[model samples]
Target: MAIMVRSWERLLLASIHDVSPRFESEVDSLRDLLSPHVGYRIAMLVVPNHWGNAPIVAGSPFASRLRDWADAGSEIFLHGFYHRDQARHQTRSARLKSRFMTGGEGEFLGLSLEEASVRIAEGRKVIEDITGRAVAGFIAPAWLYGPGALEALEEAQFALAEDHFRVWSPATRRKLASGPVITWASRTRARLASSLLAAGALRHAPLQTLRVGVHPPDVRHPLLIRSIEATFNHAARNRRAARYADLLD
Candidate 1:
């Protein structure tokens, strides 16, 4: 018998989500956890105004810190215009998803194309102004985009946009087929169970690309934090660190 070695490019896409003035400490803590162990660039999914409040003002200490991270080679992504759910759902299923699935936090769940465009543009500009850097990508909060999200994303001229399962080029609408992401939500028992199952499954799967999306509140739970650390260790075993922007290039 002979042994055969297979080689593939493995990428670890890690990000800290819901970044705003209110969640600064949590984001900072997540960054500290990722800085040494991941050995790759991480994406910071910043919300211009989170929950209709806690806006990121320009030239403030918070904005300055974001600039520092951008200078250090981390990619900054516009998460959402306002990370709050206000859209009215037309269908029962949609309403159920909005209220239960996301805990009423899917900001773009039912927006029209024109409205989505305006909000996305506003968020992009605000982030650019605050960070003094070009915002290259956008990711909807909770990985949920409404009817006009793609169109709005295209109009905003972001290089890339990501949903829960995959990343795509906004310009061409082409899917990258990267792989499913491993994410956690500690809001409920069902969410926790599903997230744990996904993490455990991906830990042993020999995949070419692995993404880990971390929410600011995730640090509050010790079990989630441990799972995050373990997932990073397992994924980093044979993967290189990468940013969503890198996927564009």
Candidate 2:
């Protein structure tokens, strides 16, 4: 029975991260590029106000597109409030994770429970207000969460939360799946090369589930764009695209 279940079919899940009114054009390009491979099955992680600037205003044009995206079956996730790190670093580990894991976009790092709750509640409300539907989950900016942020997610009862290593339910505290999230970086040459190489290797990896992530910068780099589509084509040959919410089913 285990073998039969495992043999049913592998699944591929993909997402567009750092989604905001700030990068609307890049987001649209990514959506158009990915539709052929994933067919709007990608999750969108939205920042309510990117860097305290590009807020998803109530009746803005971008907000309307967000609602349309949700209506078309793309899952949305509350990414962060400001999408910028402002909390004082209270520990050495927190400091290192913020510095090395991401630029300065780890907004949830070093947050107190109360602070994290405030951001989460408001961010969720903003997205829900714009989309007129519940978001699929909450994913911290740069996938870095301080302990307070993790607890706050559960307190608010978000259905799912994902990091680089796994996707899990914050409410139930259950890790539904464990796998690496394949993604590309375009800020530097070496990092971009390494990511492309990793994607090439992952194309043929034997796994029951594969997850890919795209950021707005990826659309601007031609080579990374090619690699993205290539990875999708090769991986999708065997695994069908699936939604994050489908994990519960």
Candidate 3:
């Protein structure tokens, strides 16, 4: 008998979501928390205007921070125009999903194709203007999208896009990474418990790509903090932490 071994390394793709001027302190804390465990080269999913409340102006301090991250080689993504869901869903299933999957945070979940297109374009421009570079991609808030959102993304020509299950190229619409994104939830006690448990289990699961999506609200929970550190630590030990764009190559 002959012995053989596989030599490829599994990748760890980590991102901080809902990034906006409003969540600056929380984002700072999360970034600081993740750096030692996962290193600082993590993706940042930016919301140009959050719920139409906070907008990133070109010469603001937050804008400088975005530029610094881009300069330091972090991939910037247009998370959503306004990370709020107010669209009217025609179908019962769509309405239920919009409510249950996310608490009115699925901004693209009910947008028409034209509306989705306009929001994506405006968000991309806002991010690009701040970073002085092209956005790496767009990922809808709550990882939920309607038919029209998909169509708009298909036409956006972004290099990549992601949902809960997979990361794909919007340009070619090719499935790049097929895996569940591991994330924490501090929104509800039940969800928090389940998410922590899932993080523990998924950290050791045999998968090619491990995607970790951290929200600003997560930094507030101590249990979630520990679990997040544990997940990233385990990932750091076992896999190569890389950017979302790394899936392209």
Q: What TM-score does candidate 1 get on C-alpha atoms?
A: 0.92
**Candidate 2 local lDDT, 31-81, one digit each (tens):** 998999889787999999999988889999989999999998899999989
Relative to the true structure, how large is the alpha-carbon lDDT of every model? 0.81, 0.88, 0.89
- The C-alpha local distance difference test score for the whole of candidate 2 amounts to 0.88
For every model shown, what is its TM-score relative to the native structure? Answer: 0.92, 0.95, 0.95
After the best TM-score superposition of candidate 2, give how far the Cα of residue 160 lies from its true spot, in angstroms.
Answer: 0.7
* Alpha-carbon lDDT of model 3: 0.89
The true-structure Cα RMSD of candidate 1 reads 4.8
Alpha carbon deviation, residue 216, candidate 3 (Å) = 0.6
> Ten consecutive residues with minimal summed lDDT in candidate 2?
1-10
Which has the greatest lDDT? 3
Query: 168-240, model 1: which lDDT tens digit per residue?
Result: 8887888753667788888888888788888888777766668888988888888888898899888777877
